[model samples]
Target: MTSKKSDLEAAIDAAARILDSATTIGTLGHIGPDGDAIGSSWGVALSAHKAGKTAVASFGEPFVIPRHFEFLNQEVVVPAKEFPEGLDVVVSCDSASAERLGSLAGAATSAKKIVVIDHHVTNTGFGDVAVVAADASSTAELAYRVLQRLGWPIDADVATCLWTGVVSDTGRFQYSNTSPETLRVAAELLEYGVASDVVGQELYERAPFGYFGVVSAVLGRAELDADLQLVSTALFQEDLDSADITYEETDGLIDLVRLADESDVALLMKSLEPGSVMASLRSRGTIDVAAIAREFGGGGHHNASGFSFDGVPEDALAAVKAELAKQRR
Candidate 1:
């Protein structure tokens, strides 16, 4: 008698079967396109192209790639409008839910087959074939496994993309999610000529000159909730304008805010626009920030998570504080 395949093995097989018969493939990441999103999407899209499939990678509107990820080959990625219709398969990388795809959610829904690859605990299992592993360090790690299962070649560029995802999502291997398997995957990708030093410098060490000013202003307004052991801050559009910094440049701000020795939880609220805010949450392992994020219709891992708010930053901050207070009690 044949044994039942593990979930991972089953997903890999299902995804490979669909991909094997596909002529056109579309790879998508979540809105705001973080490193894991970009890396995993491109890793699959590039491999698909190398395998003689018509492929493209894209995110939603405001289709901007962070400057740090400029090293990735831009040709494989197309703007949302240019993403072809009637794809044989659509692969979603790192997005926890279909809504997170923003405008491109329709494309995924309409695809002949949908393969969801993700590591977020909040993933909704929306795809037809989900390669979801909440315990995996990052979607990039899962993507690497899927590629290996398919016998797809991991060229230098592909390895670089996958490596970026693992590095960024693991907090340079310092985050609690970093597992032995995560390191094993990283080591294998490195063998394909991934320039780890260059990836590190681009992702962490460099930012535009204006970024420092923005960080200073945000840090200046940071607040601490001693009882809740939480540190929080807000960044407004004016703050970005004052420093000539783009919204994407603020991605690193949470890392700085979460450094407070007195706090186990950190929150950074950024104004996406008037009456709209995005809250980023981080934990030093004591609090389950992901649950807090899910309460606000968002999701993520235990240590890191985020959600969007349809109110001013002040209101959003108040709501998050109230939630944290509730969780603490």
Candidate 2:
């Protein structure tokens, strides 16, 4: 077995043992709590709760929590702002690099015993224990597998959380990482009484009125590479302010670009402060968008990724165009 896989297996084992003995546990995901973040946090929390341990799933900013995750509405699962004292273990879920962890990163660093579970490409062994799978699609999927191996068992609520993470991370099974195992996990979660239809509708079938409006405008103006495999669009602050768009509004825009028939890559440009531009990059196949994102001081998964800009959206678009052209061969 590879060292990375071995390390993950060992961490899962240790986590199970911790659950067996720990009294108080704190759990959290990265700042922009996506589906993986929500699912991993809730799945781990629910698992610990099932083991009769006191587990509170902590999240970052309010907007980071997606609307679809309203199903995870629990009184005990709250924000990471007011630190709970005397917790024996603090587990960071679905967060790989500390840089993406926001203010909660300090909490994890200062915890009595910190555990990190994630599926991002940038994990650098940043915890007392690190369980990372860069190719796992979603951290929630890994977390569920861990709990299962620990004999903690997966429940209905846990299944719902797990499914949400998987579904979101895979872009409703549209991403290249979707595999037989992913479908298998989805089937298993269904057996646990997770309403797949509810989760699906919540995730895929709904978008704000402003969301479609912005997408319509972007699509109308999107540029295409010669092969039509690369699509590019620009978004101004005026557009954002007019639609009351938040960072979350850009969540799936990159996905749309990748789906364009002509392009292997998609780029979305946004203006920073006033004169700066931030860019997001998404690609299919073996191209590593994360590396491209790193060039712009942002990082994420290989196929689905993002980056911030140093100038206006137009300038950011120009840089992204150069990068995409450079990758064509």
Candidate 3:
């Protein structure tokens, strides 16, 4: 095995031991919990519970669980508004940087130990132990390995959570990041009776009616720069207000902007609160969007990455366009 893989295996072994010995474990997902974040966090929490350890799942910020992910709410997931006292260990799932952990960073500091489990290429490698497998398709995949290493039981609930994470991060196994190993893990998850059809229906086919209005407003204003081979769209607070949709409903809208095959880069800028904007970046070719995201204090996979800008939509778009132009030159 390569030295990098060897080191990761060692880290996983160490992490498993830490988790197994902990009497109370806490899992923190990124600030804005997506499918992978929620899935991996929930999966890890469930694994700890199955192993007879106390576990709690929380996200950095208060968020309305996206409609598709509501099924995961069958179990109580604590909000990070107040960090529980006396957490023996804290694990960060699917977050690349400490900043992305939001308020959970404080909780992590108070914990006796911290472990980071993630698949983002730009991960900062924080925490006392990091099971950062950039080659893995998702954090859920890494969590599966860790659970197996710890000899934790993978009940149907755990299987379903991990499977949701795997499916989402791999784009339903269609993203280029999907590998044979990912497929094998997914196959095993299915053996635990994961309902593939239900997952598909909830994640993809069950968007709310208001989401379509938001889509129309955003995509209707999409702009293409032929010379730069870039397609971009900007959504303002007014758009969300008019569409009667919340920021959570804006999930998956980037997929529409990325449909321009002729473009090398796809960009989406969405207004968040008053002075903040979220920039979603997608690349169709050799361009590494992760590099761009890192430049703006964020990180993710190469093909898909994102950053939050402390500015308005127009400024965020201009900044991204300039960066793209510089990268092209």
Candidate 4:
């Protein structure tokens, strides 16, 4: 009397059951949350509200919300300092691993259940219930499906959040991950009156003047490797200080490096703090940066990924170059 559930349906059903059973749920994104992370976390929390469940959206780290994503409803996202206590369940979105949960790792582990909904190839299926959809364009897209499968309302506000996630992760549908299904989902979201131009302007056109200064300084430090196939640059804390910019401003600079005509791999290394280095990798689709990032204890999509190093920028760059060389060979 019943038909087999599709894989997507099964996963959504599992996630929905977990969500429905919880009286109070906490939705968390990874540390240094990005557009997809913020979008997915908020989308899930909002959907929970529509389903008559109490939910909160939050991140473990305290960050100045990126100016581009300021359009997100601030009221729905709980500040790190204000994270509530005694949540019955915690749902992590867009994060691949438990350790990457930052300050919320402890709470997630201590909670009654930890549900992981993500679209990362590197995810190892952690948590009490894992709904990982690597083929999906973004976690936000999967979050939408979870809401839809559960028959939850996706109002215009929720549509905007999911749209931002899909757009950001797909590079406005320029990335290779954009599929017919992705476009279809996007088109449906547009029906909810999602303001595409406003999102585009905020994400791509509203860069502060200080961003250009930082990009210039970092490019000046760029170095091509022996094969000239790898282009790398470094941004120290002093560089951010001198330019009066924050770490978030360097978001798109790697795109400039990845587009280099002569390079196959683009690497951006930043000194987030003393003895701590963060490296973001982007490729022209010839390489799987996610695999390389994993070698350095990081994970992400195939074409883009990042990892943090426990040493100086030079040391991190050297390790990255060595791993890249090995991978290429």
Error of 2 at 9 (Å): 2.1
lDDT of 1 by residue, 141-238 (tens): 98998888888778999999999999999999988789999999999999999999999999889999999899888999999989889999999898
What ranking of all candidate models by TM-score puts the best one first?
A: 1, 3, 4, 2
**Deviating ranges (above 4 Å) for candidate 3:** 1-3
Q: Candidate 1 — what's its lDDT?
A: 0.89
The residue-level lDDT of candidate 1 at 122 comes to 84
Per-candidate Cα RMSD to the true structure, in Å, reads 2.3, 2.7, 1.7, 2.8
**lDDT tens digits by residue: candidate 4, 64-83:** 57777888765567777766
Better of 1 and 4 by TM-score: 1
Candidate 1, residue 217: the lDDT equals 89
- Clash tally, candidates in order: 0, 13, 0, 0
Clashing pairs in 3: none
TM-score versus the correct structure, for each prediction: 0.97, 0.88, 0.96, 0.95
Task: Measure candidate 1: CA RMSD.
Answer: 2.3
- TM-score for candidate 2: 0.88
User: What does candidate 4 score on TM?
Assistant: 0.95
Name the candidate, 1 or 3, with the larger TM-score value: 1
lDDT of 4 at 33: 86
What lDDT score goes with residue 266 in model 4?
Answer: 91
| Residue pairs in collision within model 4 | none
